[model samples]
Target chain A: MTHKSLITSLIVSGWLALVLVGGCSIKTRALLFDGVDKEPPPPTTRVRRDLLAEIETLKRDLADAQKALETAKAKQQVKTADAPLPTELAKSWVELSELLPKHRSGQVDWGAALQAGTIRPQAGLDPTVLAYAEFNLDITLDRTKSPTMAARGLSAVKFSHAAHSQWLICDNCHTKGFQINNNGTDNILKHDYCDNCHGTVAFAMANLDTCDRCHLRLP
Target chain B: MPAFSPLLFALLFITTVANAAPEVMGNITYQRQGEQVADGTPAAIFPHWVHRVRYKCYVCHFEIYQMQAGSDKASMQDIIAGKSCGVCHNGKIAWNIKFDTCSRCHRAEE
Candidate 1:
């Protein structure tokens, strides 16, 4: 080959080699770690590690909460097992029995009974109705052995005269005694009876404002 | 080939937003405490949300009912005649306490 041609070829080859090397370097650098150092991806990696640590912490917290819940449940079970049974209703039953006329001998003049304080009128209750309740007490006390007989006597009475009082006083009378009406029923007392009488005749009983009259407040 | 894709980025953003958890309603039921005054009867059904709206937490939690759930002693007679929750739940204020309405407060056994 001629010297001129060889020189031209060498210069062109050198220029081409420089361009290719520059292009390759730019591509390789861009592909390798162009934005890596700029953004400090190590911080992202650290964040991922922190997230994993947080997840582990959350799992630990969840486990601790579960254990605490189980402990609380166990303590509650123990407390319930050690607790005493409630006997409020039983005591009330005894008090009611003591108030029955069967415990007293001789005829009870309901009108005089109220005057003598043998049967006190419940607060917000009608005095006349309370007197009628005395009559019911006399019959029930006389026929304690035969609930059927007592019920029959009660049913036979012209309850219309003191129907309001009967309903107010013995809301649970049938519920507590009669198997047909109150058998296996808890709180056999009917609220409708109380509402009906209280709503019509006695204003105190109407709004449930006189609950404290019969029941003592709990401390 | 193009190195960036706008559509891919938009899809990824949409997926992340859709996966967020939803808020739940606050309606909850609580059990009653103490002995069963009446056997075969379920515990009272306390509507948490309904009560929460009427009064503050302190009313029931501190003033009336204890903070601990199922720790108060309530009787059916007391409630029907107006006591405890029945003080407000009486027929005039809220629902009537009739034989048919027993199931409203006394839910069936689970």
Candidate 2:
């Protein structure tokens, strides 16, 4: 082939290989190191070496953890005197918890008690509606200034005015328990808003389990 | 009997019309935040019928708020400081700010 023709062929192949990158991300880099001459992959040769170094660090952590456990056990021996084994302590709590009903977060699953006819709350706390009521309002609290919450997969909050109004008067929250609207949800996260009662009267927020109790799927 | 029936129908129409009085209707929208409103800043909504059901016009007339909507520009800052809405929402007569979500009053226009 002519020199100019050969040069043109090289340029065409180079453009095709560059297009194989697919996207400007490390994920696309996976296609490169295969010797396809697409793009350079992240430093692959060091990955295994770095992981081996991490294993050594992890071994030291395990040894330190075991030593800390032994020291804690020695301290416990002085307090209990009988110093029950860790397995024995686990059995005791398991047996004790078996007596109480199942729970989701800190909140109890009242479904079991209500079904068994075991619970009978007073008029103030009762949820059953025996008579006609006055005001009716149900609001979904979805406002949040924190951009991280949505990314973290947290759903909006659910509130029912009809339920609370049965036991409490408007004076209980008009400007006190809550505002009409526009109040940021930051207070709810700080354990000051909904947590005021939920943490004490009911189950407080308990990790991801608490998310199911309040942030239900938006239907 | 036929003459009296026409007279009774006329009397009923007058009674119904007299009972009806002109009044400010529907909800009052407060978008005083002004042009270029974003998604989350919030708008203050004044639900008229809900309050009119319990209190008279005097409850929040020229005293608490002006007779017109544009006359009042109650912002969140003003409400929190015990001005426009804070007077009653100070945890005494009504609930205070820390009680619930701010969206209670500050909601996007429907």
Candidate 3:
């Protein structure tokens, strides 16, 4: 072949070599992206597995608690509706409120009204009456003990503690009308004390004719 | 004829109860003013049945008094200060000493 023709052929061969190298680079890039074509793998955190289990457990516990609460409420409603089996009156094992009569609104609980204090039960000698003296205590104010009562010839004043303590609490008369230490009927003469309830409540006031109510001796 | 035993039992029960005093639990009397026997001041008579009729053992026992009698020797001063019998005898709870005096608790032992 001629020298110039040979040179031209060499140049052509170089261009072909360049085209082949470019094709190889393109093929390598295709191979590098072969594994990445498909969809991404699922998330790693076991969000669905652990959280769903915990939520389910919590929900069941909550439902059980609600059911228990509802059952207790139903039982309480039935208990309130039904009367309990009879027991002894003075039995301490039972709640006294359960046996008490329906009291007035805003009034004190009579069952609780009974304090855990001392009781002068049946202070009087009359066997005919027991329920009356269950809370009753009869007190006598000796005229010899006081000069004012002695001068008036009133041997003693008969105070019916049973009549007062049954319906009224200690606070009703103590400190309000009488002091805690003042045990006599000395406060009875005061219009603010005895008359506050006696004349106002119901019982007729003891006039001059009822002088025996204060001084007469009982057999 | 079938109810004969029950009828007899009830009759006997009522008769027995009726013959006895309503409620009397041999009251205890305490008369000790530090070793020497107390004088003229009557020994205080503790009516056990009177308290037991309305209250349980816990009402007075271990609270105001001890289970063993004379274990708790009470003083008038302590009582007036709201201890022992004074818990209820404060003129409000039950009978006040101002009205009761010595005869209420301090009675001649029978």
Please name the candidate that would achieve the greatest TM-score relative to the true structure: 2
Across the candidates, what are chain A's individual TM-scores? 0.24, 0.39, 0.32
Tens digits of per-residue lDDT, candidate 2, A1-219, equal: 699999999999988878766554655575555545454546776787789899999999999999999999999877774443232232222342343356665434433433443333223112242423535776776636434455565677667666555434554444543443445666666654555445433355656766665676632
- The lDDT values for all models are 0.44, 0.54, 0.54
Candidate 1 per-residue lDDT, tens place, B23-66, comes to: 11222234454465446575554544233222323334333554
lDDT of 1 by residue, A55-170 (tens): 99999999999999999999999897545323212232234324433312222223333344443333322212222242233221123333643554422211222323322333
Each candidate's root-mean-square deviation in Å?
A: 30.6, 29.0, 24.1
Q: Which model, 1 or 2, shows the larger TM-score?
A: 2
Per-prediction TM-score? 0.23, 0.29, 0.27
| Per-model TM-score of chain B | 0.53, 0.63, 0.65
Task: Name the candidate that leads on DockQ.
Answer: 3
Model 3 Cα lDDT, one tens digit per residue, A111-161: 332443222233222323333223566877787555666666666767776
DockQ of 2: 0.01
DockQ of candidate 1 against the true complex: 0.01
lDDT of 2 at A89: 32
